[model samples]
Structures are given as C-alpha cells and as structure tokens.
Target: MPGNLIHFRRRVRSVKNIQQITRAMKLVAASKLKRAQDRIIAARPYANRMLSVLNSMARRIDPAQHPLLAQRDRERVMLVVVTGDRGLCGSFNSNIIRSAMNFIEDEAANRTLSLTLVGRRGVEWFKTRPWQVRHEFVNIMTRVDHRYAREIGKGIIDYFSASELDAVYLVYNEFKSVVRQDVILEPLLPIRRLEFEQESDTDPGVDYIYEQPPREMLDFLLPRHVETQIFRAMLESEAAEHGARMTAMDAATRNAKEMIDQLTLTMNRIRQASITTEIIEIVSGADALEG
Candidate 1:
C-alpha cells in the first residue's frame, strides 16, 4: 500500500509537471499568435492596394504585348509550395503539403513540374520524392519580410521570363480566422484577368495619362505584383500557423489539466483505500488480541 501510494504520487507529480509545460507552451503560442495576426492585418491593406493597382494596369495592357502576360505551351511548370518550418501546429503543414502533393500529381504527366519550396517542411517532404527541386528557401517562416519575398520573386520571374519555366503556381494556407484556414493555389505568372462579381458600375469621368508608357509601367508592376502576392501568402501562412499552434497548445494544456485531475483523483482514491485497509487490519488485530 505504501509502495502504491508512492507510485501514484509520482504519477500525479509527473502529470502536474506536464500540465505546467503545456500551460507555458499555450502562453507562448498566444503571444506569437497576436504578433503574427497583427502583422497579417497590417499587411492586408498594402497587398490589397497593390493588387488593385495591378488589376487596373493589367486591364489597360494587351496580354499579347507582355511576355509575363502571355500564356505559353507550358512544358515545364514551377510550383512554389509554402509551409511552416516547424510542425507542432496541428494539421497546418500537413494540409498544405497534401494540397501540394495533389497539385503535383495532377501536373505530373501533363508537364514537367519543378519545385521551389519556401519552407523546411516542404523541402523535407519533397527531398525523397522522384521530382526535381529547383530551389529551396528554408527559415523564411521564422521572419517573413518583403526582401526575402522579393529575392524569391526575382529568381522565379527571371527563370520564367527566360523561358526556363513556362508557368508558375503557388500553394499556401490562407488565413480565414483563428479557427479556420483554407489551402489556396494561385497562378503566379502570366497575369490573369481579375474577376469580380457583377455589380452596377459607376464610371469616374476621368482619364489619366501615362508618363513613360503603359507597357513599361506594366513591365515594372508585374514583377512587383508577383512579389506582393508571394509576400501576402507568406504572411497569411505565418498567421495561420501561429493561430493553429495557439489553438493546439491551448487544447493540449486543457487536456493535460484534465489528465492531472484524473490522476490526482485516482491517487487520492488509492490513498483512501490504503487507509481503510490499514484501519481494518488494526481493528482485526485488536479484536484478535481481545479474544
């Protein structure tokens, strides 16, 4: 009984320690979630405005006039898969990876697809696969900035423009809310027409003149647009990862607390049973002695 009590007490202590660790992890995840969410929110306006400007510019330019806007007989495709570097965030990474795999499988026989992975998770996932990896950018999830995105964007644009890759696609998790994230695949090159819902349109009776030329402005804007899109995706993925981690850690903490409570209850029950047994034994001994 003494041995059982000691063992049960140890188990209770172990669970309590795990509960503390889980609580700490939950707090840390909460802090990171706030910062990541703030960053995503702050970047939304800039990304949206950039998209609006690009849409306006793309509407004015003839698709045949711009190489980036020209659709080719794509024999080679480049997939830029974005995921988190770390994997404690529930199914965030798995969702993106699975979507990416599906995408690759869909494009496998149709076109020769090359990979440009943005996170360690994606890189590790594709390393053993029989596909080709053109480029990989690890540790980008730690701190996603415009510079990192621009560098990646520039390389991809250069390759695609040089006809190394005929088409480019990006896959990432889009942050919807704290509890929801959607896997998204967006075409990166060959700027497509912006589709919006039908609505009664009001025309501003004002026309603006271009300084240099529409083609030149598009030449500069298209690459920037791609960079902005990638940056926005990175931000969304980051925020979603943090949100998932926060939720997962919070659940883990709660589960740990519940487990500790159950263990403690069991320990207390065992101790009480031991006490009852000892009392019964003592009473039996006294009765025998009296007899």
Candidate 2:
C-alpha cells in the first residue's frame, strides 16, 4: 500500500510539472497572438484599398503592355508554401504542407511543379521529396517584415519575366479567430483582377489624372501589389501559428490536470485501504487476547 501510494504521488508530481510548462506556453502564445492579430487588422485596410485601385487600373489597360498582367500557357508552376518554424502547434504546419503537396500532385502531369519553401518546417518537408525546390527562406516567421516580402515578390517577378515559371501560388493558414484557422491557397503571380457582381447605381465613376503614363503606373503598382499580398500572408500566418499553439497548450494543460486528479483519487483510495487493514488487524488481536 505504501509503495502504491508513493508511485501515485510521483505520477501526480510529474503531471503537475508538465501542466506548469503547458500553462506558461499558453500565456506566451496568447501574448504573441495579440500582437500578430493587431498587425493583420491594421494592414487589411490599406492593402484592400490599394488592391481596389490596382484592379481598376488593370481593367483599363492592355494585357500585352505589362508582362505581370499577361496570361500565358502555364507549363511551369511554383508553389510558395508557408509554414511555422516549430511544431506542437496541432497540425497547423501539416495542413499547409498537405494542401501544397496535393496541389503539386494534381498539377504534375506534363507540367513542371516547383516549390519556394518559406519557413523551416516547410523546407524540411519538401526537401525530402522529389520536387525541385527553387528557393528557401527559413525562420522567416521569427520576424515578419515587408523587406522579406519585397525580396520574395522580386524573385517571383523575375521568374515570371524570364519565363522560368508560368504561374505562382501562395499557400498558408489564414486566421479567422482564436479557435479557428483556415488553410488558404491563392494565386500570386500573373495577377488576376477581381470583379464585383453588382455595380453601384448611385456612384458616378471618377476618373483621376495620372502624372506617369498609364502603362508605367500599372507597371510600378503591379509589383507593389504583389509585395503587399505577400506581407499580408505573412501576417496571417503568424497570427494563425500563435493561435494554434495557444489552443494546443491549453488542451495539454487540461489533460494534465485531469490525470493529476485521477492519480490523487487513486492515492487516497490506497491509503484508506491500508488504514482499514491496520484497524482489522488490531481488532483481531484484541478479540484473541480476550478469548
């Protein structure tokens, strides 16, 4: 009985220690999540407005004038797969890698499918595969910046211009809320212009004068638009990663607490049984003495 009690006590102590680590991780993730969420929210307005203007300008121009706006037969493709640097985030990185691989497989027939892995997790996963890894940016999520986005955007632009890659896509986790994250697969290069279903009846279309030629303006704005999108994706992935870590740690902490409770109950039962045995033995001795 004493041995069993000691074992249960040790198990409970071990679980308590794990619970402390999990709780601390949860707190740290929560703090990072707040900062990441703020950046995403703050960036959305500017990006959206700029995208709207770019789309309007794109509709007014000729596709042949700009290589970025021109669409061609996609014989070669690239996937920019973004994932987290670390694990224990509860399938956050796995979902992204799986989605990207599925797309690559689906598009693999007769076409060249390449990868630009961004993050240590993604680089590790794709490196072992047979696909050609064109570029790798590890630990990029440690600090999300527009400079990195510019570099990535420039590489994509160059690849498309040189006809090295026909199309490019971005795959990452989009943050919906603290508990929910959605894996998003979106096209990045040979930029597509978005159109709305219904036009506003009360709005008079305003035409603005441009200092630069229309084609020159579009040429500059198109790259900036791509860089903006890359930056936004980085922000979304950061928030989603932190949210996933926070959720995983919370679940682990709860499980640890439950295990500790069960161990404590078991220890109490064993101690009670040992006391009962002692009481029964004492009573037996007294009766024998009286007899």
Candidate 3:
C-alpha cells in the first residue's frame, strides 16, 4: 500500500508539471490568437472592397478581355494546401490533409491535379505522396505577410498565362469562431461567379467613372485581387490555427488536472488503508501479549 501510494504520488506530480506546461501553452496561444484576429479584422474591409470592385468590373468586361476571366477545360489544376507549421492542435492538420487527399482522389479520375504546399506540415506530408508538388512555402504561419501571398499569386498567374494550368484552388481552414473552423476548398482561377451586393432598398446600382477602360482596369486589378484573396486566406488560416491550438491546450490542461486529482485521491485512499491496517495489527499484538 505504501509503494502504491508513492507511485501514485509520483504520477500526480508528473501530471501537475504537465498541467503547468499546458496552461502556459494555452496562454501563449490565446495571445497569438488575439493578434491574428485583429489582423484579420483589419484586412477584411479592404478585401471586401477589392472583391466588390472586381465584381463590378467583371460584370462590365468580357471574359475574353482577361485570361483570368476565361473559362477553359478543367484539364490541369493546382491545389494550394495551407496547413500549420507546427502540431499540438486537435485535428487541425489532419483534417486538412484528409481533405486534400479526398480532393486528389476525387479529381484524379478526371483531371491532372498538382499541389502547392504552403505550410511545413503540408510540405512534409506531401513529400511522401506520389503527387507532384509545384511549390512550397514553409514556416510562414508564424509571421504571415502580404508579400508571400503576392509571390504565390504572381507565380500562379504567370503559370496560368503560360497555359500550364487550367485552374487553381485553395484549401485552408476558415476561422469562424474561437472553437470552430470550417475547411474551405475555394476556386482561385478563371474568376467565375461574380456577385455584387447593393447597399439599401433604394439603391439599384452604384456606378463609378473609371479613368481607363474596363478591360485595362481589369488587367491591372485582376492580379491584385488574386493576391488579396490569397493573403486573406493565409490570414484566416493563421487565425484558425491559433484558435485550434489554444482550444486544444486548454482541454489538455483540464485533462491533466483531472488526472492529477484522481491520482491524488487514489494515493490518499491507499495511505489511509495502510495506516488503518498498522493500527489494527498493533492493537491485536497488544491484546495477544496481555492474554
């Protein structure tokens, strides 16, 4: 009983140490999440305005005016997979990997699809797979910047212009809330399905006079729009990752506390039983001597 008590006491101590580490990790993740959320909030308005402007322009111009707006046979495609650089988040990286695999399995029957990995986890996982990887940007989740998005957008645009790829898509987690994230597989190329929203019931449409023709404006704005979209997606993914990590660490800390409590309780019970047995033995020995 004493040995068992000692063992459980040691277990309790170990769990307490783990609980402390998890608590620290949770706090760090929460801080990071706050900053990421702020960045996302700051970028949303500009991103929305960019989309609105593009929608208006796309409606006015012909698809023939811009290669990005042209519809081509979905022969060759690119899947840009965005994952976190690190793990410890619950099912965050695995869900993305699973979704990417599903996409490849479904699309392989018809089209020639390749991958553009964004995070270290995705890059490492896809390396073992048979699919071809066009590019990889690893370790960018810690410090996501617009320049990285611009570089990726430019490469994709150039590749599409060269007719290397027929279409492009992005797969990432969209941060919906602190505890929830939605996996998104969004189309990035050929710029299909343009929808613009009106302000009020009285407003039918708002028109603006452009300094250049619609075609020329599209030629300039189309690339920026793609970059902005990619940047936004990266920002969302970063925020989602932080949220997932924070939630996971919080759960882990709670679990550790529970384990510690159970262990301590077991230890106490064993100690008490040992003490009771010793007392009974001493009393019986005294009675035997008296007899």
- Predicted model with the maximum lDDT: 3
Residue lDDT tens for model 3, 1-291:
777877888889889999999899899999999999999989989998988767766655567877888789999999999999999999899999999999899998888989899999999999998998999999888999999999989989998888899999999999999899899998889787555464567743445567988668777889999999999999999999999999999999999988988887888888889999999999999999999
lDDT of 3: 0.89
Q: Worst lDDT window (10 residues) for model 1? A: 199-208
Each model's lDDT comes to 0.85, 0.88, 0.89
Predicted structure 2, TM vs. truth = 0.90
Predicted candidate 2 versus true structure: per-residue lDDT over 1-291, tens digit per residue: 798889899999999999999999999999999999999999989888977777776555567777888788989999999899988889899999889988988999789998888889998988778999888898889789999999988988888978788899999999999999999999888777555445668633444477988678777888899999889998999999999999999999999999998999989999999999999999999999999
> How should the candidates be ordered by TM-score, best one leading?
3, 2, 1
Model 1 Cα lDDT, one tens digit per residue, 21-89: 767877887788788889999999998998777665555556676778777887899999999998878
Colliding residue pairs in candidate 3: none
Q: Which candidate leads the pack in TM-score?
A: 3
Report the Cα RMSD per candidate: 2.8, 2.5, 2.9
Give all TM-scores, in the order shown: 0.90, 0.90, 0.91
Better of 1 and 3 by lDDT: 3
Cα lDDT, model 1, residue 58: 58
Q: Is candidate 1 or candidate 2 better by TM-score?
A: 2
lDDT at 3, model 2 = 85
Candidate 1 error regions (>4 Å): 194-209
